[model samples]
Target chain A: MTEHPGADVVIEAQNLDLTFETNDGPVHALKDVSLTIDKGEFVSFIGPSGCGKTTFLRCIAALEQPTGGSLSVNGMTPDEARRNRAYGYVFQAAGLYPWRTIARNIKLPLEIMGYSRSEQEERVNNVLQLVDLEGFGGKYPWQLSGGMQQRASIARALAFDADILLMDEPFGALDEIVRDHLNEQLLALWARTEKTIGFVTHSIPEAVYLSTKIVVMSPRPGRITDVIDSPLPKERPLDIRDTPEFIEVAHRVREGLRAGHSE
Target chain B: MKQVLAVLTVVAVIIAFWYAASVPMNIRGVLVEAERAGEVVDPPKAADRRQIDEFELILDNPFAIDDTWEQERPRLPAPHQVAEELWDTTVEKKITSKRSLVYHAWVTLSATLLGFAFGTGLGILLAVGIVHSKVMDMSVMPWAIVSQTIPIIALAPMIIVVLYSVGVQGIIPKAVISAYLSFFPVVVGMVKGLRSPDMMQLDLLRTYGASKAQGFWKLRLPASMPYLFASLKIGIAASLVGAIVGELPTGAVAGLGARLLAGSYYGQTVQIWSALFGAAILAACLVGLLGLIERAVLKRMGMA
Candidate 1:
């Protein structure tokens, strides 16, 4: 059983090491990685490309087993937790099936999880409403804009009622204007759902905008260098990032990344 | 309009050549009958006013009899003669008559459908096995290709004999032979289709933490429909060939193949031509039916 949120830890890792045995030689993907994510807390992992942030995300999702180390999600192993439908994952790309309409795709998890027909329909409608895509349920994935596709993917994950969201570069494929709009909408959703999110990205501002705590990672060694807590208020929007308080936290995250670069 | 006229002209020239080629005098014949042990195996039948061979055209001079001695070339038979014969053999006499195309066609159709179903089922099952297991990928796939390369005619006699000795008779043996030859395309096509989900789509499923079976059912199967249907078209054609070959080896009592055998023995050129056309039409109709089913199912799945 997963320990409650107030029990002080929902995710904990100790001395996590991952290695890949390829033809070239032994490639170290992650080393001495350790972290914690409190329940209902929003955290973003940002670093240079090939920094093993995705590896770490996948390790937590049980898609990849670490070469060595102990990792736990709400006390259970990632695999066990996953079997229990514990986390909802959003990928770097929208990854929507072109053949399926928005409503049907959102119903995918519900089908696998064996929801009743009425419940499946209800949850799909609810999530579509949540993502501001209520009227667009019947539209095919290709018919929608890139941002809309991403939102549909989010709604798919959100529809399943999982408390944790593992978003790997969810808005990485969208343009700046759309990205900004989605970031604000995401923050609003986060505030409403209070999901414990693990977001991976390369954009510094994006990490700062959504994160309660920003984990700065560096490549080569591929380990976390710093975890900077945000001082900004919980109620945030695009304008919040322009404020003095937000800039200060952003500056600290930058320093943490710089420190990672130096060390 | 000009294109239509050109096409008609081409058809007319072809027909004229065909008429000249069928002139009786040009035909070479030796005995055209066989007898063994003083038994009449196939006796020469009574010749009508016209013989099919090249000499009959000059002898009869049916065309321009009273006029210019210009005989209209003797036709192989007007197409209507063959059609009337076919209708008489199939619909008029039905299966009870000795010269029934209906009985023979039924025999062939039954085998083709049985074999097609078996082959389709086997192919789908093998494709699933390949998609799921590394052992099958390494083992079953290589052998399947080699199996196709062996001349099916050589293989048919062996298949028929072996199955018959084992007490497997009638349609099942023939169908199994058909299936054996027909399944390879479906297996290859479906395997490719199942593997069609690339790294990006897989990564998406991974992010969702979908189980292996879930990934297959939700993504792989749906993605494979177009490939499966395309393969079905080829697979169905091969199945018909397999069934006909199966019938040939068995010295089939009733089938289009049997008609060919009977026609050859009796020197009935029209019978051979008509039976071949019937088989061709049957194969086309079966393929068309599968296509209709494919379109309907894919549309329902929203994959059209």
Candidate 2:
């Protein structure tokens, strides 16, 4: 499970340094944090609270500009990548427009990107079916359960088929049963679509359950502690979590997470 | 039993006082006839027995249209009399009839709707400007609040007079007045509504590479629907006020306000009351109609 140099690189962060000039003082969120994600790779950023996992995701999405060092996505600077619409971002919260129905919510990104009306309709329908929300297209966001709402948000991200998918703990608010269910569905979707995914999460098992490559991070000037590569096979079935290799990777992730939290 | 009798007695005593108070007023008119009939009458003050005259008139049914002393003694016609007058003049008469309340109401309604439209449009436009530019926000927001503080009643006449000087008569001046008063609420409401999206949502749009205009059209405008409609309801009410005020200042001869004035001139209390009520009903209907439109638009947008 060592680094595959021949893998297709989608994003490369070189000596990244992100500092915030708050009223208190200069607070460094990310110090010389560097990583490379391959095309079609399922990468997870897992760490203790306040470890800048969300911040790194935001910076990669071009929602926040990195203060120092170069961060590139799809061979362009993050800002250029943003202008090129190279990524789809799903925030921790569903962030669904309450006024919009499930189908229309999914179509929001496509609409903003100015897809033709027919294209928008086609993409919306496809994504809605992908999320298993085919019959709930006309239902409002408020009317759906929290899990369904989150799935709709995922559908929204998937609608545009961007090169990179940036997810900030997309299921941080869902219950455990629903979380497990979605995790399997997500892995299945990723396997089918072959899209590069960058997920941020705080849970060790959840991280181990989904990630092909897990970047373990620590707080206090957030830096990567250990990069855990899963040898548990890329084709993740729900029963894979019960396999010896999957359990071994999960234990390694937990140990790395513990060390990261302690220090 | 004693307390009940005492309460009844007190009520009787108040009635007696009320009857006594009207005696002088009735006698002043009634004694002129007694003197003409060569009755051995006392002085005007002593013969001023309005209570006795009222008692006799009530007992004999004064409005019975008898040959002897045929006259209706109406200090103030009762509620039923006013209703009858209103029905005869407004509903019973044709819509084109001058005395018809419906015609007057229509005139006032047209002015109100025109003013409301003008006001709401100006309000939304101003709100967009204020939301987009800080310079306009600082310069116009203060003036908007100050303008409303000037009292629409005070400004309505001036608006009419100025518009008249420029040969802008009919409903235009009234609509302008309505718009002036109504736009403030819309501006305020829209500004708050347009700014409702949080930083994350804005960043989401930014990451999507949406330009400012695109972001507004796709995100900001849809988000502001609830606030916009809420403010519109208030603006429409203000528009009605502006129209009514507009009519008061101008010599609007065919509107509800004109009817109010004509009724005042002749001391026709019932006419004035009826016109006021009709104007209220018209305003309510106009506001309700706008609400229905708002509901329809929200439904189409899937917001409600």
Candidate 3:
């Protein structure tokens, strides 16, 4: 892992720490967090609430500033990378503006980045199709169902065509059936786009099913306890989770979480 | 259609009550006049004759009910009497004539519209400042609340006197008063609206590297649309009231407030009622126009 091919590191964090100063005192959100994500990798940060998985994702997006250690994205500081439009972020909630139609909502980042009218229209159309939300562009966020709204939000994140997609529990609020369907679609999306994806989730099965590299974390001064690289091939299907190898990886993630808790 | 019918029903009930009230309110003066004219030879015992006398008056003069509704100086003028006066002073008279209600209305409306514009602009600026700066939020917000506590009636005379002494008389002083009343709602609404975006939404913008200006224009301002319209409705009504109040102290010969003062001095209850209704109708029109604009804007934004 230490000798991972040079120049392939898309995200490198060393001893990253973030302590939030509150009225009660200081709460350590992340401590001694270190990881290296390679290009085109689908990495999942799996932990319980307060484990700082979201916090870490926020840090990579430059939404939260790390207090200690070094973190870089695309060989630039997180802030610099953010300024360069290095990634697209999806929040837990859909967060689509009710005042804007679905098409306009998806076109927001592109508009901010000063894309021309024709380009914005073209990209909006492309991403809407990519997310299978065609012909719903003129509808408002409230007009759509929860799953559809989440897909529209995903379409929004994809509209700008960023090389990295950072999602903070994007499907956490959906029902199990909807979530499974979205997970499969996400895998297919990653296969087509080949974008570096950083996904945060609390579901064990979801993390194992979707991620190539799973970072298991623990709370009480949050830190990564295990980094598991899957032995499964890139060509994955919904049935892959039923394989013995998949069970072994899931077991390892569970043991890592338990061991961290015991210590 | 249903809403219009409901409003008509309410108006009809109010008119009926007004006519009934005018009979009792004007009967005393009418009876005194009758006694002075020797029409009632000898006054009967007050308690015994009350019902009988009232019946007799109605029987003797079939026009008594009509007379009650058409008195020149009634204590409570009947709705038809007010409506007649409104018609004579608005449609019968030329629009440019000094005696016309339309001319007076225009004077008051001009002040109201100008004051509303100034107040809304200033309020939005202050709200943006208050939202972005903690110092402004802590300092200006409390002072704004304190300002509203001082009655406009008390403030109006003083403001008029001060402005007159400084040679800033006429429409400007009245507009200043209107502005003073209208700005508070705008400030409160805009402040709330500007801060309406949730933490996740703000963070989402931040992740996109959006500047503060971009955040305000795209997110905060758009989110504030419903709030701004709500406050504008309140602000415009307050401004009309302010303009009328401003006219009272100045003793102007034009505008709705001056008409009210003249009616009171001459004991012309019908005229006063007409002016009051005129102001009400004017306020309704302003607020109704704003509602239409709100619908159009919100619908375009996909928020309706």
Return the top candidate by lDDT: 3
Candidate 1 runs further than 4 Å off? A1-7, A97-101, A138-143, A241-263, B1-103, B198-216
Q: Per TM-score, what order, best first?
A: 3, 2, 1
Put down candidate 1 lDDT per residue, A1-263, tens digits, no spaces.
14343545767888899998889988778999988888888889999887789999989889889999999987799988887777888988887886689999998878877899999999999998888998999988878999999999999999889889999999998889999999999988988888899999888899988888899998886899888888878888688878988888888878878887887
Model 2 misplaced regions, further than 4 Å: A1-4, A98-101, A138-143, A239-263, B1-82
Report the lDDT tens digits of candidate 1 across residue range B74-158. 2254344466667887788859666787777778889988898899899999999999999999999999999999999899889
Backbone clash total for model 1 is 8
lDDT of each: 0.81, 0.81, 0.90
Best by TM-score: 3
True contacts kept of each: 0.32, 0.79, 0.88
Quote the positional error of residue B161 for candidate 1 in Å: 1.8
Q: What is the lDDT of residue B226 in candidate 1?
A: 88
Candidate 2 overall lDDT versus native: 0.81
Give candidate 1's chain B TM-score: 0.78
Candidate 3 lDDT over residue span A127-168, tens digit each: 998998999999999999999999999998888888899999
lDDT, candidate 2, B1-304, per-residue tens: 9999999999788655644544433443445455565654444343454445545543443322121221124333333445576787787989898889988877877887888888888888998899899999999999999998897788788888888999999989888988897888899999999999998888877877878898788788888888999898898888877777788877658788878887777776667767876777777887788799999998887666
lDDT of 2 by residue, A43-105 (tens): 999988878888899999887778888898988888888888788898888989887888888
Residue pairs in collision within model 1: B23-B54, B24-B53, B24-B54, B24-B55, B25-B54, B25-B55, B104-B254, B104-B255
